[model samples]
Target: MHNDVEEILFSKEDISRKVKELGEKISKDYNRDDEVVVVGVLKGANVFMADLIREIDIPVYIDFMAVSSYGYSTESSGIVRILKDLDLEIEGKHVLIIEDIIDTGLTLKYLTDNLKSRNIKSLKICTLLDKPKRRKCDLNIDYIGFEIPDKFIVGYGIDYGEKYRNLPYVASLKEETYK
Candidate 1:
């Protein structure tokens, strides 16, 4: 797995520090007495959500949504599908969507729209990484840990064919690995 990486963009320590910082900001922003619903976009966001929620000081209810625009591919198909939906009813609840990375904004936009129609009290987005250059639609991302270059990265919950998610840090994979 290590050899497959062309370069390491962010180390484990770097990610940890950023997660802690994001958690602090989130805790400060939503310091209300009521618990907030922290929705994790499944598979990729699982690792990020776990670390982030631990840093949050306020009470939080966790749930997962498995939405996909990429299936065994690096580029987005521009078609979004929800493989799994939130188990908790988010109506009238403050909801925060946690994402591993936001590249094209298609999946998140679709998801935010879907969640908004549910009549949730409020909705915000937080992502571990963002590639604004590739955005196809405008989105208001409330929290962002890093603005990365246009590169296909894997590790730290991100993956290529489900093989690199176990890596401890984010890295760009060798072209041959994915090609």
Candidate 2:
């Protein structure tokens, strides 16, 4: 699996430090009284979400949302479909959307819109990776671990052909692996 990587973008240490910093900021911004819910986008964000939540000092409810915009293709299909929904109601709660990466942002936009309709008290986005070069819609990420160039990255729960998720670092995939 390591052989398929072209370059390492964020190492385990780097991600750990950043996630800790983000957690501290989140702790400071929201009080324990605030009904905080951390909603992780499934599969890709599993690792990041796990690490991030531990760093957060305040108690937070956790949930998972499985939306698909990509199947076997490397790029998004531009259509967001919900494969799984939240088990708990988020109305009047401070909701934070946890994502592994934000590329085209279309799928997230669709999700944000859907979540907004639920009448949550607040909504924010926290992503481990942001590809501003690939953004196709206006979006604001409240917390960002790294701003990366447009590339095919997989690791730390992100996958290619459902492989490479166990790699300890985030890395760009080799061209030949996908080509």
- The number of the candidate with the highest lDDT is 1
Candidate 1 residue lDDT tens string, 49-164: 99999999998999999988898988899999899999998888999999999999999999999999998889999999999999999999999999999988999999888889
Please report how far candidate 1 places residue 22 from its true position, in Å: 0.3
Writing each residue's lDDT as its tens digit, candidate 2 over 29-85 gives 998899999999998899999999999999899999999888788988999999999
Candidate 2 lands at a TM-score of: 0.98
Pairs of residues clashing in candidate 2: none
Model 2: how far residue 21 lies from native, Å:
0.8
Question: TM-score of every model?
Answer: 0.97, 0.98
